[model samples]
Target: MKIPEARGPVSAGLLDLLSGQPGADPAALANLHELVTVQLRAAGDIIEDEDFQLALFCLYELHYGGLEDVDDHWEWNPGLLGIRQLIEAPFEECLRSAALGCTTETRLPPEGTLSSDDVAAILFGLAAQESGPSMSRYVAKKATLEQLREFLIHKSIYQLKEADPHTWAIPRLTGRAKAALVEIQADEYGGGRPDRMHSALFARTMRGLGLEDHFGAYVDSVPAISLAAVNMMSLFGLNRRLRGAIAGHLAIYEMTSSRPNQLYGQGFRRHGFGAEVTGYFDEHVEADAVHEQIAGRDLAGGLVEAEPGLLGDVIFGATAVLAIDGRLSSLIMDAWDNSRSSLRAAVPAGL
Candidate 1:
């Protein structure tokens, strides 16, 4: 992806800065920050605010794949980092507040330290809760061809680069946590066979649907909550301060992945897709089922036992995903139920 269509004044200005020479203009940066500040003050439901979420999404994108026209030097530019912190503050506060409001088992052990098994059990219990409508069951039974395509488009924003956001936590971990993460990541990366990589499998799924398979292909079409869900991962992963939260995020992610993916594959088969099309989801069913065990017991549990302080953050990470993803599923299901598109607008496939 080249720089996408700017969603607002802030994004336009920020894109201009990134596309320009490194250290090009301080005045322009100041103006972008000013626009962002003004927008944040009046921005209702920041999670649903297109401009705010888009601007923040672009800010995080710098750390991932810098825009095609963007100079790499901008990734480390202090002004940009400062602007990143500006939006991140509120986004994080919103997430933390939402996590606090979630009803689930996040209780810590009485001894103030989790055993390898203790941490796993807490995460498992959290994953097993029914917090919202089941998008998986809906896809398994009722989704149309167009609706399935729409679902893929929404997911393409992240699935095309699956496992990357969480990979940021590898170096931040040590001992069993570190080893366990590497074990999980190896499978996600296809364990030495590129075709088997989760991202590659997902891309094949997109191609099976006759949709674009490149990263950021349908980003402009997805809604704010979609962006917000992925942004939450980047937020937890990129911040060293939130290392525990990132670990927790991955545990919940794996624990919840298998069944939904199975249903997703079933939905595609309902449309007459073969193994090539459903491979990605089918692969996850087995992979995540096994991963949930290692992640819960060894990765998450070991981390808490090694560093007791992260237990709260670990649970926060798990519940935060539950809360955020529940909202995202609700957004998709409600739109589909009403015969409306979940995207910000109707975008033709393969755009």
Candidate 2:
């Protein structure tokens, strides 16, 4: 994808340097890190801070499908890593605080030797307790076709690359946890049918709505919190030390998904969309019911049982996803409720 438009000076300078020849001076990158430190210190709510999130998103993108003309070698440039850490430190702290909330005391099971079933129950209970104004319900009963387009654009940030984030944990785990993750991912990948891959399914929905189907097609339109949600998963997944967190994260997603997906499909169908557009949500309604069990029990619970010490991190991962996604949901719903567009930039015609 082409480098996105800069959201602020930090992102602007970072993008400028990223376009330099492979081997831009480490000292120059260090100077850019200094600018980031100053910017973050004065920022209010870094979670919604567009410049910070965009810069972080671009930096992380280096490890994914990189920018159009940027040098791939920057993926590991020591200077770039230093700058990334500068932003990551505070962003991670904010996420931890959001995840903690009042649930910290009750986030985990009592201390003891717990079986996978026991752990699964705890994860299941966590998901069941998610009660609030929901994006799904709005999508089901009220969203206009334009609002639905906004909804898919917000989701496309992550859905376009579904399962890739959690797949990072495959090599980091072993035994039941490994097998469980692979099984879930296999289905996400369409079990050997390329066209049925979840990402492809999502792209079809985009096109059915008269939207572009390419990855990153709408990145610039979504708000900071939308990017932040996806970044949280990547943060947990890419770090081997956060293996437990990523496992818990996927489990939370599967556990909470099935019912909401049904509503999402209903919303699209209410507008008379056929199988072509609603297929993504319809697939999830069925798939996630099965995935939730494997992910919560065999994947997340089994990992905690084997490692014993990662239980806290597992809970953190689950709650973090809830926290981040809640923010994104509110962003969209709040805008809709007030009769405003939720995107950072207005979507163009037919989008």
Candidate 3:
């Protein structure tokens, strides 16, 4: 996507640099550092920092699918990477402090205690016990068509490339963990059928709503909270050191997915949309039911079994997913409740 209109000095500077402007000099970097330091020190809310979070999102985007007309070389440039790390270190710390509690009290699975079945049981318990705000329930029973469309827009940021973030772990894992990841990813990749790919199915859902289905088409419209939710996955997935966290994230993601998708599909039907419109959600209702099992048991459970030390990061990842998603859902639902648009104002047409 074209660089989003900047929200603050750092973003403004970065955008100017990307546009080939010459004013983003050391002064801009100094301004960025000061901004981050302030946000880091007295930041009241990590989940809602539109400026900081969106800036970080744009940095991470370079590695995934670089922006149009941006220099590809910037993806690995030391200067850019340094700035990213400066931002990311605080963001990661904020997430950990906000989500994962002290590890000292968390019980570790005893040596040799981790089996596939045991892993499934733990994930199942986590899923069952999670009581996050039910965005899906609201959508099913109370959402207006416009609200549902907005929900789809927020989701499309990630759904359009649904399994790619987690797939980064495929090479980081080995033995049972590796095999299990491949199994789940195979289905996500549509098991050799491009038409059946989850991303394509989501695209169909977007089209059914008369929304744009192209990647990053709605980036300018979504709020930073929405972007941060997706960025969390990419962060965990891209780092080999965070493989356990990614696995845990995926486990919880799948475990929590099935039921909500059922509700979402129902909401679509309630709005008079047919199977084609709801097919993406409908498919998840069935697919995630099975995928959750594999994810929690073989994928997550197996990973911890192989490397017991990763248990804490795994749990941290799961908790982070809950925390971030809960915040995003709360923001959207609250905005709609107050009769405000959850999205930023649509950008002016034709530039």
Candidate 4:
């Protein structure tokens, strides 16, 4: 991915640091750290703060496909790692607070033990609750071709790399849980068929509408909350300690995905697009229906049953999905409701 245009001073400084030698330059890192501290302190809402979110997104990007022209050595640079840690601490706390507000009633048995079924039931209940402002309904019933294109751009940040984040937890898991995750991810990765990988499928969807399918091509066009959504996945998946959170994240993700995807496919078809453009959403409608069961029962539930103490983290992970995604959906719908593009900038007119 090309290095994104800096969102503010921190991203600008981080991009500058990456452009140079990848080393512990105390003065440079310290200056960047000071900028980060000040920015974070001044941020009214870190989740929607462009500077912090963009900086964090760039930091996590190093661990993924990496930025264009950035040295591979920076992936493990101590100074960069410290900067990432500084941002992650507050970002995580913000997520936890938001998630707790949503899942206050979710609890485990008094014995501090639960079967896989019990855990799945709790997650299903969370999924069943009605969150306000449905993006799927808007896409299905009313989105213009341009709004749909804007929708894809917001999604491109994460969908183009679909399933990679949760895959991080596979090695961190064991037994039924590991098997379940691998099972679901196998489907996501197209079961060894590269062309059929979910990312590739999403790319196909983008091309059908004449949008750039390259990962992160639309990073600059999306708002901070859009980037924050993807960063949350990386934050949970990369840390072994957050294995439970990642598991629950995937579970809720799969649980909530099927219906919206169905509606998304409908929206595209309503715009007169054929399977080439709609296949990605059509595929998710069925795949996630099955995946939801496996993820809720075997992946998240199995893990919590095996390690009882992780129940809170598991629930937290599931609810965090709701909190972040809810905010993102509302942001998009709010913009659209008022006759505007959801993206920071409008995408080109599509084919």
Q: What digit string (tens of lDDT, one per residue) describes model 1 on residues 1-351?
A: 656777777777777777788777888888877877887787655766677777778888888986787788888888888888888888888888878766564566586656989888888888889867998999999999989989999898889889999999999999999999999999999999999999999999999989988898888889888999889999999998899999999999999999999999999999999999999999999999999998998889889999998988998898889988888889898999899988887575453
Candidates' TM-scores? 0.97, 0.96, 0.90, 0.97
- Go through the candidates in order and give the clash count of each: 0, 0, 0, 0
The residue-level lDDT of candidate 2 at 100 comes to 77
Candidates sorted on lDDT, descending = 4, 2, 1, 3
Q: Write the per-residue lDDT of candidate 3 for residues 133-191, one digit (tens) a residue.
A: 68899999999988988898999989998898999999999998999899999999899
User: Sort by TM-score, best first: what order?
Assistant: 4, 1, 2, 3
The number of the candidate with the highest lDDT is: 4
* Greater-lDDT candidate between 2 and 4: 4
**Candidate 4 TM-score, true structure as reference:** 0.97
Alpha-carbon deviation at 141 in model 2, angstroms: 1.2
* Model 3 backbone overlap count: 0
Instruction: For candidate 1, list the clashing residue pairs, or say none.
Output: none
Overall local distance difference test of candidate 2: 0.88
What overall lDDT goes with each candidate model?
0.87, 0.88, 0.81, 0.90
lDDT of 4 by residue, 1-351 (tens): 898889899999999988987764768878998888887887766888898899999999999999999989999988789889999999999999888767646565875669999999999999987665899999999999888888999999999999999999999999999999999999999989998899999999999988999998888889999999999999999999999999999999999999999999999999999999998998999899999999999999899889998888898899999999999999999998999878886454452
